[model samples]
Target: MTTEPAADPQAGKSWSVEVYRFDPERSVKGHLVSYRVPRLEKMTVLDALAYIQRYHDRSLAFRYACRLGMCGTCTVMVNDIPRWACRTSIERLGGETIRITPLRFLPVLKDVLVDYAPFFAKYRAAEAYFVPGEERAEIAPISPKSRERRAIDPNLECITCGACYASCTMLAHDAEYLGPAALNRAFTLIRDSRDGARAERLAAVGGEHGCWRCHSLFNCTEVCPKHLSPTRAITGLKRSIVLDRLRSRLR
Candidate 1:
């Protein structure tokens, strides 16, 4: 059998962790398990989980890949808010206890591992793929400085970590809802000068589970790791749709 890596002795020496535990193969309902860790400089919440898994218990379940926060797989609810544990330093938590749980809107596969199928499904339903036309060779070169392109610049940095989806109340209430991230993706395409799918994308997001469902609670914006605001993008889509409707009426 392979041995698990040892915990760093210098990590936070006097912090308590409360982990939400659920195993379909082993647990009846689910439970919160607590672990105490040693204090160290600049330790993150991911490091705390790593220490618990290696030294305190071997069966605890959580998901992580890149320890530096780029992979987006290490997102979890810390102190009841969705955040990337890899980037959340223990010292910044401002408390003696840290509570960890799976993302809110998705089904939990285990302790902190949420099923991403529903999240990705919404993404696919948004028709987020690029649509090209036969006249691609004749297409004029587009400048990034164009007003429309610049409008979508902030949205392109999304890592699709599902943190926004997890914190969205609109998605929690309506399972069929296409969430902020997906709608943001739609906005990007809609704003693109070369895209041929504007009408189709607008139709996709114009229905019940579309842009109108957003309540502007800003939860997605609050939890987003990249600081990109899908809320603003959704608002922009609403304005565009409203203007288009008015223009059609005038015609």
Candidate 2:
């Protein structure tokens, strides 16, 4: 755990931050508000927001848990790029002016907090779960060197923080599109030997708005905090589906 230095009133430092402000009860609208905060070395954007909430304004609202970037709850658009606030250092911002906004492709709840219901709802719709077979009592061993297991190695690290979804242009145009994380999870199960839901899972994601919707932008791969590439998983799913279809035609 990294402990931030105590606020120094005598410190000759200041930063101008543009924060998106919204209160459901206060107004039917939202806008950006500027706040000047004392700067400290190694201070993060989350720390800046917390300082403003505690000192300058008590009404500011945002979502954050496990401030060390594990939970992925502090994700937001910093200068139009998706990043975890806890991991972004204020010194690396390159300027004294900071622009903050709610994540794109989601409903803004208040301030920088966006409603995640739709994101998680798509996860459920994609049936992103591991299904065990009836022969569970028999301990079936799968070699780590197997192609399927090796393929799913990177896809298994997803934290579902909605960063990729927020950065995705597919969701920006079509809300029904299953975002990368869900598709990645689906692909993982599709390749699992223990899963009995492959056919059903394929049916769920084989539509026009399913795995085919990915445009190969690689934006999900670019913004993932855990460095997991959902785009790769999605591509693997497409290959699996195409091979299966071709095999069926041959039969």
Candidate 3:
């Protein structure tokens, strides 16, 4: 629950928004700062933050880009759920008060701005990169109907917004776990026909800190704005690992 800031108890056509504020240089614990805003038709949660910034407080900080649902940068916790602020309509949430906070499981640098370094660091740890073919004199022909391409089509939508990462309970417990995004990226690479580093990519996502750490909670899938399923991708990795082991045994 958020502590409502002291304001004039005047009732009007306005909504109360609680934004989490913190300054790593000044404050050790973040606190909820409330803002009274005029309710507008089709106003989004992002719109409310902007209104607060423009008319209420310019110092209020949050991230947004594309102003549309495409960029996942504007994600925040709306009523304890991770959502894209730009696309989340205040009316849709059905509350006179909204509690907005930085995405969970990440360090907050300031108001609604969390440090993404540790989140992106896992990408490197998982080696989430597309390694080109060793002897690629020409582009490898891949069909639109190819099984490899189809297997990875659903997972290619990740914007790496860390929504899934923030929603992941596993990360709160296992610091070394690669989490969903990196493992999903690895799964795509492993399924890509043109990727030459299949074995290396597989190794990167197969161990204790890799896809094995996923608990199948599907929280990653639930919070994904693009509707991509990292859980499915992680399961694919596990299946690949098992199949590879069976092949090795047979050989």
Candidate 4:
């Protein structure tokens, strides 16, 4: 007589979670470490990480702030796609497996934590700060229907998560590329009529490493956690560059 094996009740409730492990302090090179995690109702990627941190491994390193997904601090590579860990649910990813890693284009500081120096450096190179139009005594009124405002509004909700910059294919190839986040930031300022730095800002984002270099593959738009479109902004900047050069020739 053949005996039938009993089916485990926990069969479909567990997942294979592989996280990229690295720690220069411990002399461990980067590699993926697997963890078997049990499924919970509506559990998020960040929740899984938190569970691992609390129960399985105490030495694992990751970053998160404003667990509500407001700070964009929990950004990581989830199955080769950059995402906000706090907001990405396990159920949405098929509940079978998950792989987490540091931003592909940035230097890894530790296990999933990346150094954002280069990302912000390119941001500063674009002169992203507002060279405010003469100090306003009160709120300077900008019409909602104005063409410039319309062009600039959609691109301004960026959380500076470095997700767009990290996912950019240009950065994967060229280390010096200004990247989508920087160029997108420059576009916002350049389109503002009240801003005094149009010429300088244009120069900042228009050189060999600037908006003209965007491949327009839409990778930046795809991986952005905030849904901001850096491709659209870069295209607008390219148009402005052409128009600016023409105006200069006419003058």
Candidate 5:
């Protein structure tokens, strides 16, 4: 975590970084701490945080991994918008001051770090995983052009970073709501020809606290790091439920 301050050659351009700070163990109330940092070309919010920690304040805490944007772990609220810190370039932001905070709808563990336990709990409640079918001597082959394959292709890119979960307004009001990430995972598995527990998966996500609760605000779609759309996936689940009910009634 230590780096020579001189290593950053572009330490001339100054910008203010306003960070949300709190610790339940040490502090009664959380507040924002400001630091003026040097900006470089292509400097990301993650870079700014690293600079702040390395130079201004070692006590500043945040979560980040694989600074290349492939890992969703570096997610933070930038000016009230949920975005991957690594992916957001400071140059793109036309402001001299940037507000950095932990994701919303989750308890803040510290500065820019939020508790994800509740988020994963919703995931499990939705049964967001593939259940393999009976074993066979040979592996099954699925065509790339198949409807199910095409339907789930984009969703397979989900990194489970909780960006969609954090950006979700639905989760803010309804804690029990199976968030976009979980429901999106459910939709992917439901559409997968390789998964055998489609009925059970559907039941999990179609319950009272599931896909039906989504208000279709599309916040999940806007904040997705991988550019995948959970709103579309949740809609797919809703359509499946309607078709299933219609089939049962007709029979």
Candidate 6:
């Protein structure tokens, strides 16, 4: 895919890119490989990666889809910070050299690609999915201004991007800890009055390596593409757990 571009004065400018390379099926170790990329106006990190994979080295492997950042396929560490590659412009990066690497604290299946199984497993452990009650004749209308809806609103937009999970110091220390996204998901489900598994889900998130384990570092919130606040959700869980226990003792 070594395609010569049409005449343009900006063609002379290029970005220095260093991408991590690995193939578990073949090699036991990995290394960083560098390439020179053309400077296109408002170009993104994903654009650079595609250029490398196509015009430079077909063997280079990375994942991407829906280049609009809705899909987390192009998630990677740009200069050791977790971010969506498709949305990160080179201009925003503010440097001529771009360093790309895989997300940390997960098994790397290939270059810049981490297995999402562990991240998702924690969500399952937290019982993050909604457990609906018996089927009804009609859908129940939830008020937009209701307390439950308001509580669930700010923390409900998680994209499952794993940027928070990757940047989390808590997860790095204790792998058993239910991380930001999973805990955030649990909070949303717990706040829904219609969910059948409120007690069970609340107990799950309030237990060991659960919401209490979070240090409120806010790393997840910082890198969140959708601007969700998992730290705050965890804190809400902590408050709910305490109140629920106090009520039980009083009763």
User: Highest TM-score: which candidate?
Assistant: 4
How much lDDT does each candidate structure score?
A: 0.86, 0.87, 0.87, 0.87, 0.87, 0.88
TM-score of each: 0.89, 0.90, 0.92, 0.93, 0.91, 0.92
Q: What's the C-alpha lDDT at position 220 in model 5?
A: 93
The candidate that achieves the highest lDDT relative to the unseen native structure: 6
**CA deviation > 4 Å runs, candidate 6:** 1-12
Off by over 4 Å in 1: 1-12, 134-142
lDDT (10s digit) by residue, model 2, range 1-251: 99999985644578888999988888998899998888887989999999999999997888898998788889889988888999999889878789889998889999999998888888788887877866666788778889978878898877778889988999877899989989989998998988888877887877777888999999999999899999998898888888988999999
Residues 1-251 of candidate 1 have per-residue lDDT tens digits of: 99999985644458888999998997677888888887778989999999999999888788889887688888999988889999999888888888998988889988888988988888678777678643655756667888877889888877788889889887768989999989988888888877788777787888889899999989898889999999999998898888888999999
Model 3, stretches more than 4 Å misplaced? 1-12
Q: Ten residues in a row with the worst lDDT in model 1? A: 133-142
How many pairs of residues in model 3 come into backbone collision?
0
Write out the backbone clash pairs for model 2.
none
Q: Is candidate 2 or candidate 4 better by TM-score?
A: 4
RMSD (Cα, Å) for all candidates, in order, is: 7.0, 6.7, 4.0, 2.4, 6.4, 5.5
What C-alpha lDDT, on a 0 to 100 scale, does residue 27 get in candidate 5? 89
